[model samples]
Target: MALQILLQLIVTGLAWGSVYALIALGFVLIFKATDIFNFAQPELMMLGAYLSFTLITALKLPFLPAFLVTLVLMTVISSLLEMMVIRPLVGEPVLAVIMVTLGLANVIRGMTGLIWGYEELQFPKPFSAQPIMLFGAAINQAEIFTILATALLLVVFFIFFKYSRAGLSMRATAEDTSTAFLMGINVKRVFTASWAIASVVATIAGVLLATFTYLEPIMGHAGLKALPALILGGMDSVVGAILGGLIIGVAENLAGFYLEQYLGGGINEITAYVIVLIVMMVRPYGLFGTKEIERV
Candidate 1:
């Protein structure tokens, strides 16, 4: 019984962690490319899930088509947001940009509530409902699919960043926007593309989350949970985001499974924040972030 419970917790943690990681990746991606900390990522995820629900449930669109349409819509919205709001704020202080993101997050949350109402809504599963057996342990098919999908997306993203021309431009812009511009790269376009990609990732994460838990307005707050992963993985490291996410997910699950019995209440949610605090205190630059020296 003990072993079984432990395995169950591990599986649950990985599943939830992957979702958190996906959210964190959005933050990391935008931050890496544009140095903007987008607090609206979770809301973007919420928007994606709601959009999916609307297309499938209300508009009566087919599942695959709805999913594709949601992706395209999210990409467009992200690009527009960058061009309209974020672009104007270029060269602003980090705090200023972050504040804008925070405000945008709230705006999105409110709009989502207004459009979809406050009630929790279910999203249809894109995979089998049955749990799959793995090495004597049973895991939900949806969870497995989520993990696989995230991994695949991450790999595809990695390849794009490594080899694609647009990806190269993004990396150039990220390293030094002024230099990238001097080198003929369109820095503004890169920023817009970064946000668009982040939006797409957020949408996929939201959809997967809705598969596991019912969709709600507050679901965008999942971005808060992913913050620790961003910090741990380093603000500029994509792979670091993945690693940070897995760590947070595993730690939260273990904490909830082992410590919750003694401490009581929901420790998993609190665990990520605690981890972030500890990481910031110890390694301020994060695990993979470049060290910066402050002059006076």
Candidate 2:
């Protein structure tokens, strides 16, 4: 019985962790390309969810159509954001760029509230709620879908980053912006692509999460929770992001299951941060993060 409960928690954790991983990937991708830590990422995730909800509920579009449309719209929106807001800040101090992102986050959050309202809204479920037994643990179809969708998306990302011409250009640019431009790589296009891709990834995560529960502006907080995963995996490593998310997810669930009873509520909420703190004390740069040295 104990083992069954543990398995159940692990499976559920992986599902939520996948969402965190996707969110973390968005953060890492843009940071790698532009060295800009986008504070608006969570709000972008929130915006995706709200836009998806509006498409389905207001426009009466089916789930598949709504999902694709949301992706297209977010890609354009993200590109515009990069061009209009971030492009002007080029060559500015990193602190200035970061502050702009913080301001952008508030603007996105406020706009979402004004448009979607603060009330929780029901999201159409893409999968049935019926629980199926997996290795003696019951798992919901929605959880299964979340995990599978994450896997598929990761595969697609791998292919894109590994084989696509644009992907190679982005990689080259990320490694050295000046050299990339000297080599004739279009750095400006790569920046737009990175933002668009990050937004699309965030949207997918947002829509998947909405399938599991009521959609509310507060759901963007999940992006904040993903910070530990981002830090734990190393901010620049994609594989680390995925692994860190899974670890945090499973650890939080296990902690909540076992420790919450003794500690009296909310242990799960703090578990990810606590674990990251301990890990960083030892690794400093994260388990898989690259170490950088600068000469005076």
- Output the number of the TM-score-best candidate: 2
lDDT score of residue 15 within candidate 2: 86
What ranges in model 1 sit over 4 Å off?
none
lDDT of each residue in 1-296, candidate 1, tens digit only: 67877787787788778988999889988998988889899999999999998999888998789989999999999899999999889889989999999999999999999988999887887777788877677878888878888889989988999999999999989888889989999887888999999999999999988988888999877777788888898888887788888888888999987998898969877998898889889999888877889999
Q: Pick the candidate with the highest lDDT.
A: 2
lDDT: worst 10-residue window of model 2: 125-134
Q: Judged by lDDT against the true structure, how good is candidate 2?
A: 0.91
Superposing all C-alpha atoms, what RMSD in Å does each candidate have to the true structure?
1.5, 1.1
In model 1, the worst 10-residue window by lDDT is 1-10
**Model 1 score (lDDT):** 0.88
Clashes of each: 0, 0
